[model samples]
Target: MRLIRISTNYPAYIQNFYGQRSALATQPYAQQYQTLMADCYSWADFWTQAFGKLGYEVWEPVGNAEPMQKMWAQENGVSYEPKTWLTDIVAAQVKQFQPDLVLVNDYATYSRSFFTHLRQICPSIRLVIGWCGAPYSGYENVFKAYDLVLSNIPSFVTDFRTQGHKCEHMHHAFNPAILKRIKQEQNTPIDFSFVGSIYRAHNFHNQREKLIKQLVAATDLRIWANMMQLSAAELKLLPLKQQVYDLVQLLKRLPLGQTVLPYLPKLKSYARMTNRPGLEQYVDPTIVARAAPAVFGLAMYQTLADSKMALNNHIDISKSYASNMRLYEATGVGTCLLTDGQDNLADIFEPDREVVTYTSAAEAIEKVNYLLDHEPERQQIAIAGQQRTLNCHTFDHRARYLDQLIKKNLA
Candidate 1:
């Protein structure tokens, strides 16, 4: 299968092993990370190389210095700059690397035009794939140019398909190397840990906000957040512009234990976040890897080993889907999974059996407290969940699912 992947970066360790391995099926996994545009490792680089090694012809377009140049300008907070030069340069590269499919990761301002230009040049391409990690906007017509759109959310696929385009549900993968690295470096016993941010406070409910606050208050547990929230006094204590940056710095220093919630803003959420500064800078992988690693959550299988209890909550969106990446990760690690109870959650895993679910903030707290006190029951749930992940949810299984989907669509 000859495919072309156009992502921001394709480095294996960073992009969840999309482009590093020389597998049986991979040949030319041509990919590139826009280094001038962003300072982080790119997932595109990893996948492209992986496919290339597997016997696919890999073609990466690098003639576009304009995209990287524009990305560099954006890094310093200059949004008014024109990227015509960058787009022209990238267009030349696109012409050279033309292939059957174009795999897109986050479709931000930096790479949107790149996809549009590719479609203009090659309409007969069998597929153009866009990965959606969230249920937000800017996807209205951006995906219209593509053959398929993929996301973990089934509701998202339903909405797109209803609008008259083909789409599919593809779960995200954990990088085996990163997991292996974390496992090797930390011998610390697993304990309860939560990763991700409590900022974007407006996007969450009062109850959800309360739950986060309560976790912050608990001393027995190691509470972590992307950054510490400003107390009423702290907010009042700083200068306006400086306050935001200070908050960002504070969040960087605070031990989040583990990272969760990959935030790629769709159009509306992007606009809603006007007042929030310093968010764009956090996209770098090195910055992400720095938060206190003693306890982390989010990865489906490897994260469970970071802590005994992993907090799993649904991001407020159009649907309340309970079965998330963390659900599997926590279970797979044999870490006691305490997740928010959502519709259809029980269908995915037996409540209080393979995994445990809670409907309210109080319920979540109570469950965590109970699980901490009852070690034997906690271990039982952990073991069951771990066994389930190992048996059913490995990347190898998911890869086959992708292969099937591709064949069905092509046929």
Candidate 2:
């Protein structure tokens, strides 16, 4: 059976990833696809490659690669709107490929109605499969579009089945071939680092941000994410954000508080810039000061390989599950992974042996310091963790399970 696998990138990464490839814009689609295949990011083509091994013809299309999409749209005579642009590209590809199943990895771009609309347009489409690892808070009926919904997070599967939707648990895995794509470091110089999302909308990013803030305060922790890019003016005002907050407290003590009330909103605005939640562009100041420029795809893998210990925290939605990509990526790349304590973590890696787990921010800090100081123990865990991932958590293993899942649904 032939199927299609679709992937999307963060708009920032799309710009960052492709903007560097200005020369590729003038090149043909085949060369563009060749360049795309070289950089192994988030699932990449691993799943479909695994599916290919299991004797299925799978076509993987990156829905957000604009240059390739533009060329294909022109060739296929497909017109698209801004909002529906991503799905438009995928639908056109489905029409071109004429596949039985179209698996969408990005739920943000396509909703239930869009999936419904896809089948309406592409009669060859027999199954619509979706994959999500984060909390899905769209319209209540959003998941109804898919014949099967898959998540690495055990909690997400539980939520889906509890809501009476058909869903399955598929753990996230690493592609060891990623190591071949990037240069290997003989020595890991960075002591502790984190390379993932810091956006507030992500399930537990704020809580993750809090833990990171504490870590930054106490340890030599470094972070890399493109989420917060403050302008010169914003950077100048960061220090003032605290002073403005202090001034507001001082003003509150004055008997003439009524007079300054008109300007309170202005003062509080700067305070919220560093302290409160709604400030989307800024992460915590401590992290902002320590934040390195974002790394993606192969750069991310290289960073993981160069770090002695990579920190991981689950989104609030993960709820006692150790299912995020970092669990596999960090360990697979042979870095000691110090992750938040999860109920199912032992199922994946033996505690204090294959990996390290921390129950609280204080414990995370304590364990991180302990691990960094004790290099032999840490390296042993790293070696064991990588072995565990290589043996059991590669995408090839996940592919056999996914193949069964797809066929069962088809049956």
In terms of lDDT, the poorest run of 10 residues in model 1 is: 24-33
Global local distance difference test of model 1? 0.53
The clash count for each model shown is 42, 1
State the displacement of the C-alpha of residue 89, model 2, in Å, after optimal TM-score superposition. Answer: 2.4
Q: Pick the candidate with the highest TM-score.
A: 2
**All candidates' lDDT scores?**
0.53, 0.82
* Tens-place lDDT digits, model 1, residues 196-262: 4433433333344456556545524443434433445644544664564444444444566113112
Residue lDDT tens for model 2, 130-236: 88887667755767888899998887788889988789999989998887887767678799999998876566577888888899999999898655657678667
- Choose the strongest candidate by lDDT: 2
